[model samples]
Target: MSGLAALCFLLLQTGACGFEILGWFFRGKSLTHEDITERAILNTTVQVCRALALAEGKDFTFPPQPFTAESVAVACGASKSSKSFCKAISLIQRKNWNVDLFRFYSSRHHFDDETFIEGRKIITEGLSAVKASNKRENFEAAREKLGNILHPLQDFYSHSNWVEMGNNLPNPNLIRAGTSIGNIAGKYNVTVCLDEIEKRNA
Candidate 1:
């Protein structure tokens, strides 16, 4: 029995076993790794979607649109906006709170360096895709598109950063700017418009 216990401990430390035996010792229920990961994914996905919605000026309470696997793949394959949408969907799907995950991992003596690194990697990939798609045109078009959509507030175009200003400006006008951005995001069904704005700003 002692040898069995030792073997279980070793397996847990090595991440070789699905079940975590230490749960019994810690007065917690045992759970499989896949189960935990799936739950985490779902939680993360919901949160991310909510954040995206909020950024676009929409209420986060609306149910997430059903995202099929094919849709996920296609969106991921699309331009920078699509990639950003994909990442947001993926994170929302995970449904796990990042801070909680960090704490849980730390409690288990696991490092979360990869989590942060992977997030940055995804951002980089999305930026690259957007840039590659925009190479054919100058930045002016992108800024114009954003300005057109955000015209309700104001209209200013930034060529260097590709930002289109609506009536809401960002410094003396920062709050209004954020409000305009959120409202625009909420109004659009397709995420491509917002994605373009992000690409320009990037």
Candidate 2:
């Protein structure tokens, strides 16, 4: 192999060619797991707040763009340091480094290694635990459980070809138990254009 080819292979193995080689695929946006999770949380919170306002005959004011936990908390009349919000964000971010630290990256954690079934179970079980804790008024425990699930859930989109598969929306079945999450490509499947990636990097 040429020196450049060997270097490219090495970079690929180390994930050093990530955004530079795959940016076009994601519309040139290199959203980290935390970024996507935070956005999702903010969006969902806004939607819920709007619904509540409508039901109570009040105006729902959005927290404004570049949303952060503090802004959303203020708009929603919650404390920024609420264990349900800001602390949850911290826990979710830690999943990228804290969970299984010093151990091999679990397939279920990043939706890698084609462990979709196991990964889904992790999410479902975590959600259940969160709900149970919340029912008992244990917000701290609920936040931890929620954070654990969000990490893997967000990783599914980042690691999978859901968008490339022509999915315009999220796979709703992922959150629902006892439903098929759809057929997943096996590990050997060439879901991405490796040659295009190589050419772009080269």
Candidate 3:
């Protein structure tokens, strides 16, 4: 490969997800996207191992890789994390035409919208099974489901005007049932983009 091409590929492998919305999750937690993924997979694997060890007297085995569901399966003694796990993770996190990105960046479908309750439910169910069951299949299933929810949850902050509402903190009640996200402005009076250019000229 050409020098520039090799550098780009190296960067791709070594670089973090610098996309603002996606990177938000890793900002306070890990320096790179790979690290974040490894951490999450490890968390799921550890939880499953712990639960399995407790429920069935099995030994805990760590995840074998930071990428590829196949490696995770080897570590967990599953067939392949699932029939289609690694492929799904790849497709889900793909840059263009990825449903994960589309939904995560969808602002009007606001993060706190009640319609999005399914995401939280997925996480809760997955975690509950991972914590209480000896089934590796069930545990991995939960991990995958929970995996799909996190991007949008982190994207909630970047896509909304929460930073503009004069509060330095995110709304603590974003997804809680029966809680308010506060009274949204009845008017869309905020200036943006072209307005800013016009105002500057005015």
Candidate 4:
């Protein structure tokens, strides 16, 4: 199996897989913004770790279970880079996270432009780094970066109507090069309701 597929399959065993994919439906609003992003990171990390374990022909388990960014931050608190990374990760806001790259990757958006090409290049490099490296720390960093890149790709499902427009299927072209994103509009669009500043705050 491909490393990415194997990673995802293993991540599903962690229960975080369900949380990351389906939790957005029932628990999205209940989940803290950090919970949403951190869950994605945790699951993605599990996938990478599992893939590494498989490659090494060993079993693996992530301790300090129910892996939260807070727990990891505390555990790696002494490392300045880990602390900075964790802090930055916790700041993923709904409207602002991955804002720049979000527009470049879609049949609805640009259908494979410079931004899209660059994004894919980065992800391919990140995945290669994760799979080919023996350094745990480097793997962790690469996993986090890969998750960040993937965050918006997954968001493509939540943010756009490909499921409807493409007959309840995903626009597979979004992940590939030299293909149209179906008959999507010129931009990927979704109507989401955001909590506005309260009158008290105003």
lDDT of each: 0.32, 0.61, 0.44, 0.46
Worst 10 residues of 4 by lDDT: 10-19
Model 2: pairs clashing at backbone N, Cα or C within 3 Å: none
Count clashing pairs, candidate 2. 0
Task: Estimate candidate 1's alpha-carbon lDDT, on a 0 to 1 scale.
Answer: 0.32
Runs in model 4 deviating more than 4 A are: 1-35, 62-65, 70-88, 91-155, 164-172, 183-202
Q: Between which residue pairs do clashes occur in model 4?
A: none
TM-score list, all predictions: 0.22, 0.69, 0.41, 0.41
The digit string of per-residue lDDT tens for model 1 on 61-177 reads 533345433343343333335555545434432322232334344421121332322322332343334344357564444322222222111111111111322322232221122
The C-alpha stretches of model 2 lying farther than 4 A from their native spots are: 1-29, 79-85, 100-104, 186-202
lDDT of 2 by residue, 1-202 (tens): 3221221122222221122212223455465444554566666666666777889999878888987788888777786445567766666555533443432367887678778988888877887787788789997787666667765665666677765565655666666678899956544666558898999899
- Comparing 1 with 4 on TM-score, the higher-scoring candidate is 4
Off by over 4 Å in 3: 1-42, 64-68, 79-83, 94-106, 110-149, 157-175, 180-202
What lDDT score goes with residue 36 in model 3?
39
- Overall local distance difference test of candidate 4: 0.46
Angstrom error of the Cα, residue 184, model 2: value is 2.2
- The candidate scoring highest on lDDT is 2
Tens-place lDDT per residue, model 4, 24-112, is: 34455344323545665556555565666779888765548787655544443333456655654544433223433464335332213
